[model samples]
Target: MARFLLIHGSAHGAWCYRELIPALTALGHQATAIDLPSHGDDPTPYQEATLSGYADRIVSELQAIGEEVILLGHSMGGYPISLAAERLPERVKHLVYLCAYVPKPGFSLNDRRREAEEQPLMEAIQLTEDGLGWTVGDDDLNRLFYHDCPPGTVDLAKAHLTIQAREPSTVSIETTARYAAIPRSYIRCINDGTIPPSYQVTMSEDWPSERVFSMDCGHSPFFADPTGLAGRLDQIARDIT
Candidate 1:
């Protein structure tokens, strides 16, 4: 069975993967998720959260796992997972980008978002007064993230979502051959409202045809179709192995 490490996106924590974790386990693979600094129950202040801090937490978890794992990053999670793999390539068997940003050398996630042809998510973001963090607007959250999700998903998200530190998205990252050598895959959410499906295609256009998969759901597949997402991940595990 393949072991999986799942990382969440902006303002979200491990709680977002509640459905998918058990679904994957039922499929005979091991899956674990963690709260990045300042997210979920993490006590770190949003002002203190940084991209490197996120990467460090992921690295520590990988070291504790003590074995190779398939690292999956959802949305803004791609940056940290990429950095973690760069730091401990030996512990990562593959990197999976799930409707997530794939970092370009020297470019921050914010830079990539700005580069996208369409700025669909811009309307939903509410910047804090200090300019250090952002939160999703209440009205836009359901429309952008959970339009296709189950009944309780939006409520769960509303209760747990926290301020997303802007620093992490503003900092650029550098990767070397160590990170490039790892197997990589991308799962595009075809109906994603936050990150346009067309942009997802643009991001993964250069990847091998076999490495790019698509889901017919919006941004939050964990709640929309957790079992299907787990099955797709299982297929990815098999394909890579």
Candidate 2:
């Protein structure tokens, strides 16, 4: 069985993968899903969090595993995961980006977002009064992040969704290698409104391995199809090995 380290996106915690972890674990893969800094119980202040801060958090988590593991990142978590894999490529067996940004060196998440149609939607997202963070209000939650999700699942996320840190989202990424050096794969969600499918296809073009998969779900595939998602991840792991 392959060991997997799953990273969550902006404002989301390990709680986002609660449904998927058990499914992956039941398949005999050891999955470690942890909250990003300042998002969950990490206790880091949002004001102090940067892209490097987030990358440091991922590296710290990767260090705990004695064996090489598949490093899977979602949404904004992709930036840090890419950096983490570069820093310790040996420990990262393969990098799986789920509708996440896969950027070149010195590029920021904003750069990737600008290359897509997501900029307009991001600019329209609600922000805190200080303009330090971004979040979707209850009215836009279903349409933005999980339109295809079951109404009940959307309601559950509405109750649990909290404000995401703007600091991390705005921070630029600094890296040494192009993502093409790693055995990378893209898991595109076909109907995602938040991340335009056009942009996903463009980003995957730069991947070295080019092992791409698609789900007919929205941005939050883990919530929409945890079992199917986990099965695909397992298959990818096996194919790579």
Candidate 3:
């Protein structure tokens, strides 16, 4: 069975994968989730966060594991995982982007969003007074990221979501041929209101058909459809092996 490292998206901590982790484990796979700096319980200040710091955190985890594992990145998590793959390609058996950014050599999250055919998360952002972070409006959070999620799920998300740092959003990722050589796949959320489904398709048009998959649920499928999500992830991990 494949070992999996699940990275959460913007304003989210590893706690967000509570359901998906167990579901993946039920498939007889070892799944682990980690909080990025300033997220969850981490004490790093939001103003101090950087893209390199995010990547380094991921790379440290991979190095400690000392074995190749499937690295799954959600939302903004994609950029850091890409950097991790670049730094330790041999330690990453596969890179999976779940309604996540599919970065190119010199594009930041903001840059990609600007280039997107359509973006749904932009209007939902509530920037911090200090200009170091942003948060989604409470009402928009349910609509944008968890429309299909179960009742009470939105409340849980609201309670746990951290203020996402802005530094990483402006930092563009740099991918090399070596990182490109690492097998990558994308799981598109067709019902996604955060990142439009059309935009997801646009970003992955060049990828082979087999490398792209879709979920009927919204962005937060881990909460909306854990069984289906887990099954698809299991199949993806198996296919590459």
The candidate scoring highest on lDDT is 1
lDDT of each structure?
0.94, 0.80, 0.90
Q: What is the lDDT of residue 82 in candidate 2?
A: 84
Worst 10 residues of 1 by lDDT: 115-124
TM-score of each: 0.99, 0.92, 0.98
Indicate the TM-score of model 3.
0.98
For residues 132-212, write the lDDT of model 3, one tens digit per residue: 999998889888988888899989988899899999989887778879899989999998988888988988888999999
Model 2 deviation from native, Cα RMSD in Å = 2.0
- Cα TM-score of candidate 2: 0.92
Q: Which should have the higher lDDT, number 1 or number 2?
A: 1
Give me the overall lDDT of model 3. 0.90
Candidate 1 per-residue C-alpha lDDT over 2-35 given as tens digits, one digit per residue, 9 for 90 to 100:
9999999999999999999999999999999999
lDDT of 2 at 61: 84
